[model samples]
Target: MLSTRRRQFVNMLIFLLLILFILYSSILARFRTPEVALDSSSGSFLTKTYLGLENEQAQSELISGSSLHNEGQFVSGNPQSSLSSLSSSSNEPETINKVSTAGVPSDDVNNRNHISAEISSERSVLKSEKKNEVEEELHRILSISPVVIFSKTRCPFSVRAKNILLKKYSIDPAPHIVELDQHPLGSSLQKSLAALTGRSSVPNVFISGQSIGGCDEVIDLDQKNILATKIYELGKQSIKVQLRQTT
Candidate 1:
């Protein structure tokens, strides 16, 4: 009966020991849970920080890309964006100067074209008016005297004609001589005279506002003795008109 009691006591002691061991294991598991949770929280914080850094880097890239676009450039995923930015900064002034210079030349060219157009218009107007001026002037000079001689002083034919009319002939009124070579509108006058009388030379002789001929005709008339008679008749007519005006 003692042996049986001792065996039951041993079994009871083993059961109590097992219970204490189980309580100790449960306490250790509870303590280790906090450390595991702290480790997990720390890992989560690290991941969040890494994600924040990535977000900041992405935002920075977007801002830089926008700024580059504003500067008149486009770069997508290019490694040389920094170099491109520096080059753009360096060339910005040159580009501005080129644009300004280009604009100024266009303005200058437009101004020059405007001035040229005005000058051309004025020249055309003057050309049209010159014909009338020459014609009117010729008529005025022709009416200055009854007998007119259109001549140049340097012309040999004119010198011969003047010697015959001025030195050899004597009349009541003198012949009005024009030195076309010394005249301001000499060339235009010569052209008009040629168109009117069909003669383009000096020593053109006119009688009573009518072109008789040139030096050859006058020499022929003087040699034929008809020049003196013609002069006397015209002189008498002019004197009679003057006398009537006076009366």
Candidate 2:
């Protein structure tokens, strides 16, 4: 019976050891860290070297007061303008003065003056052409009537002259009156008339395309009794011309 007990105890110990081994293996499996797979894709040395060089260049350009932002390429010098150097040195007064004058040379100034004079001459020509057009229009109006008066509707002198010429005299074909105040080319006509007759004021009377002067002169001629004679003679002439045209 003692021998049988000893073998049974040995078998129990072996069974216990087998159970402990299984428990340890299960615990190790639960807490074990998994291994990760790594890729073999390291970049080449040349690419790393080029990236390092570009970073160094960008840093250098930033320190030199310039940047690669403008053209996406680094520039060598500071991005400041040379014009600001005008106030720097006292010995460069002539250069400073040149810069002060907008850096334009003396020859360029002379050329500009010449161009300005040419433009002034062109403007003068245009004015003269406009004046000629006004004169031609005035002449056309005068040709249609035996008598023409360059007068302003608002002028008392013009009213006075109209009254005398149209009311006092029994002239045929009443005088053609241009009320400059109401005309579109009124100011231009006045300028043309002044240039032609040398009489700048209104009430500029024209008899048979001839200037009979202003209101003062017309009244003077009437007081002398020659104004009526001149008007009737011109009226007779116009009547004869009309009669001939009809025939």
Candidate 3:
């Protein structure tokens, strides 16, 4: 039952109260309380104390510093002390004047030199003795044979040389024929004989304890007609001696 003008005035007052309420709420949301940080000097002091404790612990681990009666601890300042202690624990100390198992004095260089010289002289003597033994064996082989021929079974040159003595001269050189390829010691003996006689080739021909070269020399002597005369003289002497003994 309120008049129109009175109603309008009431509506305006209510609108104004609602706007003021919204403005107050927005301002309150924008304005925040400031956060306080810890003091820098206090934090730094705490950090230094922690680092000092850690350093003391490291020093104590590396070296035992103080007297047993006193509780005070000392820190090692030398950097090499830990390394030196590790090395000493690992290896036993050795003296420079220690002697060896061979009874040689390790302290003197002259003793080592003398031992080396003696070892070398012994090796030289052993080598010389071996050489002399080989020489004696070779000498025996050469001195026992008046005619020696080293040949191979399958070699054409060996067959040709044998044929010249047997068929042409009618001389049986079987006892003097050395088949080098068939014998076990033949190769080594042939090499030694060849080395001593200064003949580097094989199918060697030696007559009257002399090396007459190879097949070519024998063929040359046959072509010269001297081979037949020599064989005839050897055969005649043998036959004559045999006839006299039988009579």
Candidate number with greatest lDDT: 1
Instruction: Report the candidate with higher TM-score, 2 versus 3.
Output: 2
lDDT of 2 by residue, 116-233 (tens): 9999999999988987788788978898778888898789999999888776665566678899989888888888888888988999988787787999998998888788667656
lDDT of 1 by residue, 1-247 (tens): 5698899999999999999999998887786534344555567767666666776788888776656466476655556866886687778644322333455755566678899999999999998799889998888888787778999988999999988887677644677888999888888999999999999998888877678788898899888878866665755567212111122
For all candidates in order, the CA lDDT equals: 0.77, 0.74, 0.62
Note the residue pairs that clash in candidate 3. Answer: none
At residue 226, candidate 2 shows an lDDT of 83
lDDT of 3 by residue, 104-165 (tens): 66766566689899999999998777666666755565555445566788888777877776
TM-scores of all predicted structures: 0.48, 0.49, 0.42
Supply the global lDDT for candidate 2. Answer: 0.74
| RMSD, candidate 1, Å | 19.1
Q: Evaluate model 3: give its lDDT.
A: 0.62
Among all candidates shown, the one with the greatest TM-score: 2
Rate residue 193 of model 1 by lDDT. 93
- Clashing residue pairs in candidate 2 are none
